[model samples]
Target: MRNNAPSKHVRIVLADDHDLVRSGIKALLSMIEGVEVIAEARDGNELIALVDDLDPDIVMTDISMPGMDGIAAIAEIHARKPGTRMLVLSMYDTVDFVKRAVASGACGYLMKDAPPFELEQAVRSVMATGSYFSPAIAQRLLQPSEPTVDDELTNRQVEILKLIAQGRASKEIAYQLGLSPKTVDVHRARIMERLRLNDIASLTLYAVRKGLIKP
Candidate 1:
C-alpha cells in the first residue's frame, strides 16, 4: 500500500557502451511516469559533452566505458554542475568501486541487474530525498571498515593512502582524483596521524602489510 503525488518531469541522460543495455534501460525508464530519456552517450567523453549541452536533471551511467570512464566523467560533471544528480547504473559493486563512484560525486548507486521496480524506486527516491543507494550497497557502505590498526580512515583517506604508498606525489594524486593538492596533503597528514606513522617510508610499509599496494 502506498500514497503518492503526481510525478514531476525528470529529464535523464543515460550513458553506457552497450547499445542493448542502453536500449533496455531507456525502455524501462520510459515506463516510469514523468521520466524522459533526453539523451544517450556511449562513453564518458560523449556523456560529458551531452551533459554540457542538455543539462539534464539526472545522469544515469555505467562505470566502465571505452574512453575516459564513468568515474572521471562524473567527477568532471559534478565539478561543473553540482546541481545535477548523478545516479550510477553499473554492475560493479565492490567496495573500492562504490567508494570511488561516491567520492567522484555520484549521489545514487544502483546495480544494472537490480529489479525493475527498484529502478523506479531509486529514481523516485533520489528525486525526493536527493540520494539513493541499493540496499546491498547501503549495507556495505554502513559496515565497519579499516585497513590498518590504530584508527579508521575514511574511504577517501584510504584511497589517498594507496596512492601515497605507490609513491604518487600530492599533485599527481590530486589530479587523478580530481582534488586540490592541498586536499591531498591534508588527507596524507590525517592518514599518518590516524595510523601513528611519521614518515612516508613507514606509511608505505604499512600499506604493503595491509595489502593496499604491492611490494
Candidate 2:
C-alpha cells in the first residue's frame, strides 16, 4: 500500500465516452483516499484537451471513443506530456488492444470488470512503480508471443497493418506510432509488397482474413 505524502494527492483525469460508465468509475475512484478526479472527458479529443489544461498526474481512459480514439490520444499525450502517466480502464481484453495501449505509453491497464480493490491497487502501483496490468493481461504478456498473420510480417509491420486495415491514413498511423510519414509509407509499401497486396482494399481484406480486424 502506498501512503501518499500529506501534501501530494494523486490527481487524476477520467476519460470514457459513456456517461454512466464514467460516472461509475468516478464514484469508485472517489472512494480511494488521497486520490482526486480533477476532471472528466467524454471522448479522446476532450481528454486530450483536458490533459492539456489540467496537467493531472494520471490519466485513466477507456480504449474506444467516438473521436480520435483512446490509443491515438494516449500517444499524443505521451508525446506532449511525458511525465503524466496514462492508466487504461477498458473492457477490451484482447492482447492486441493491450499491446497497443502499452505501446502508446500507458503505464497501467485494468479491465473494467476487475475487482474494486484492484482499482486503488492499480493507481498505487502505477504511482509507485510506473506500471500495472490486469492479472490476465500480465499473464498474456508473459506467455509466448502469439503468431500473428504470417511469419513474414514483423510485429511493427503487423501493428501498422492493423491500423491501416482500420482505415487509418499513413499520417495518422505515423502520429500514433511516433514515426515519420516517410517511415510509415516505406513500411506500408513493404507490407503491400510482402503480402502481394496492390491496394488498400486487398490489404484490408487480408487483415480481416488474418483476424487482424473484425469484418
TM-scores, in order shown? Answer: 0.67, 0.70
The best candidate by lDDT is 2
> What TM-score would candidate 1 get against the native?
0.67
Clashes of 1: 0
Stretches > 4 Å off in candidate 1: 1-6, 144-215
Against the hidden true structure, what lDDT does model 2 obtain? 0.86
Over the stretch 1-215, how does candidate 1's per-residue lDDT look in tens digits?
A: 12243268999999998999999999998888788899999998999999999999899999777646788789999999999999999887766667778888999999998989888888888899989999999888877654332136776887788789888999999999999999999999998898889999999998665545546
Estimate every model's Cα lDDT from 0 to 1.
Answer: 0.85, 0.86
Look at candidate 2 and give me any clashing residue pairs. Answer: none
Error of 2 at 156 (Å): 14
lDDT of 2 at 133: 94
